[model samples]
Target: MLLTAIAPMTAEAAGEPFDDEAFLFEPKWDGGRLLLHKQGERCEIYTRSGRIVTEKLPELREALADLPVRSVLLDGEGIVLRGGRPVFDDWAYRLRISQAAKIRTARQTHPVVFAAFDVLCTDRPHLEEPLTQRKARLGELLQRGGGILTPTVSVEAQGRRLYELTAAQELEGIVAKRKTSLYIPGRRSSDWIKIKHPRLIDTVILGCRSEPFELVVGLQFRTVKNKPVGRVSKGLTVEDRDRFLQAARELRVRQEGGVQWIEPRLCCRISYRDRSEMHQLEDTEFLAFLWDKQPEECVWPYT
Candidate 1:
């Protein structure tokens, strides 16, 4: 079915996933978020950005076509597994494969699977229905041992354990949803909270300090007022450390306390704890230099 407007609902980040009887928790799959729609032998796929990608992943469309429902809209994540863990790096290749022959070859090498999370529109419209009810309907619609798409396995009142397990398994994290929450399309509501493991963030490099033995780098988020929100001095491979030092030197703007303040031109991705009231990212550890993310995109929550 051709949907003129089927914008998927968005989730807001939470400080951490909490265990509550009023919520259901599921592992937040790390990959592209795709909305699958099937109508009377017709199946189509859409990215969260509203791009129509039906022909991109033929396996996904074929899998959805096998469903028994006449009309259904399923929200899911398209993940490619590597060593039993979802990896977005491989998913990038899947998304970039455009040629029909190349797509088939890529699918074989790195197959993508769907983990359905919600049922937006089924036999009847269910968007207005509370998430608790929608989840029940979703389970009924896609039972276990189904095709390529499987409903997201969720836990009730066990968020703390779930988050720990997800982290230990080197997975992304868990998404906690209020049982009574409705699926409000295109809305980033607090009712559905995203509690990612290893809280990864993209920040702009503001400066660096030469500590007694190591180099401590300062990073910030917002560009309007570039205030250092965190410090990262360790957790880098030898190659990364060299690359960082070279970038800092080239982008140097000033010097203070043996610290070379650099222009906010380079961006880096890192894992950090929640920001303190004083606006500092505590326990910040470097993950990788993010050349893909522009410095202008580094906007912290201003919390």
Candidate 2:
């Protein structure tokens, strides 16, 4: 069976980090989630969504192919590091390149490191094995640091401390996994929890774009002025898109330059990294529609 057919286990989001002896904490790498399957001398990489990306990352293929094992299935994150921190934008750009010439150039300029965290198979399947056992096997199979393939470092029970360190390092966040949990394919289990450091803001819907579908959001300033912050589309579900569009049609005020202007009555909370000089939200993702929030309540500075 193709490894891509096996969906990687996902983590539930946690609001805050806590000290837990039952859980092992590791850095939540800020890049694409990938699964590598190596059989004999052939290796393939797949995205979380199961798209085969082996061709896009030839260097990773070569590295995995060189592994001493006969066959292994590994779950990891593909990241491009700069100044000791993962640079997601560079990794994202690397995923988009298709031309052979450009890909060769990118391999030299922005090489990606695969941070293996979980082992699904090594000579045989290990899905029923506990996470600790799987990790132990993984460590024995692979080298620890400074390589194209590296192990994801984890602390036994210092979830809070790891979270703090990641925040200080400007890293993505931390993941806490139950030490005895078994890998369940395609499931979002509570055994693993992800704690991210993202600032949340509630913004009123100002307008929307049809093609590809993005929400133009803003904040109310001085009780009357509307300040456009940014456009968001990521994390919107099919239901969310349908519901928002249905409500938007009723609130349609005007259309300008392909944007469907709507009355700023609907509000939603979004997670963002920071704001630009123009005050536009950066790295913004839609969280949820705020049915209880009023447009006036989403004021500037987002207090």
Which predicted model would earn the best lDDT?
2
Clashing pairs in 1: none
Stretches of model 1 off by over 4 angstroms after superposition:
199-303
Ten-residue region with minimum lDDT total, candidate 1: 212-221
RMSD of each: 10.0, 9.1
How high is the CA lDDT of each candidate model?
0.77, 0.86
On a 0 to 1 TM-score scale, where does candidate 2 land against the true structure? 0.72
Write one digit per residue (lDDT tens) for candidate 1, span 1-303. 245447778788876668899999999886888998888877889888888888889889888888777788888899988888887667766887789998988778888899988888877888789888888888887774255788889999899999999999877788988898888888989888888766677788777765532334344433445666777865766787678787677777788877677777788877774444345676668887887777767776321
Score candidate 1 by TM-score against the native: 0.70
Clash number by candidate, in order: 0, 0
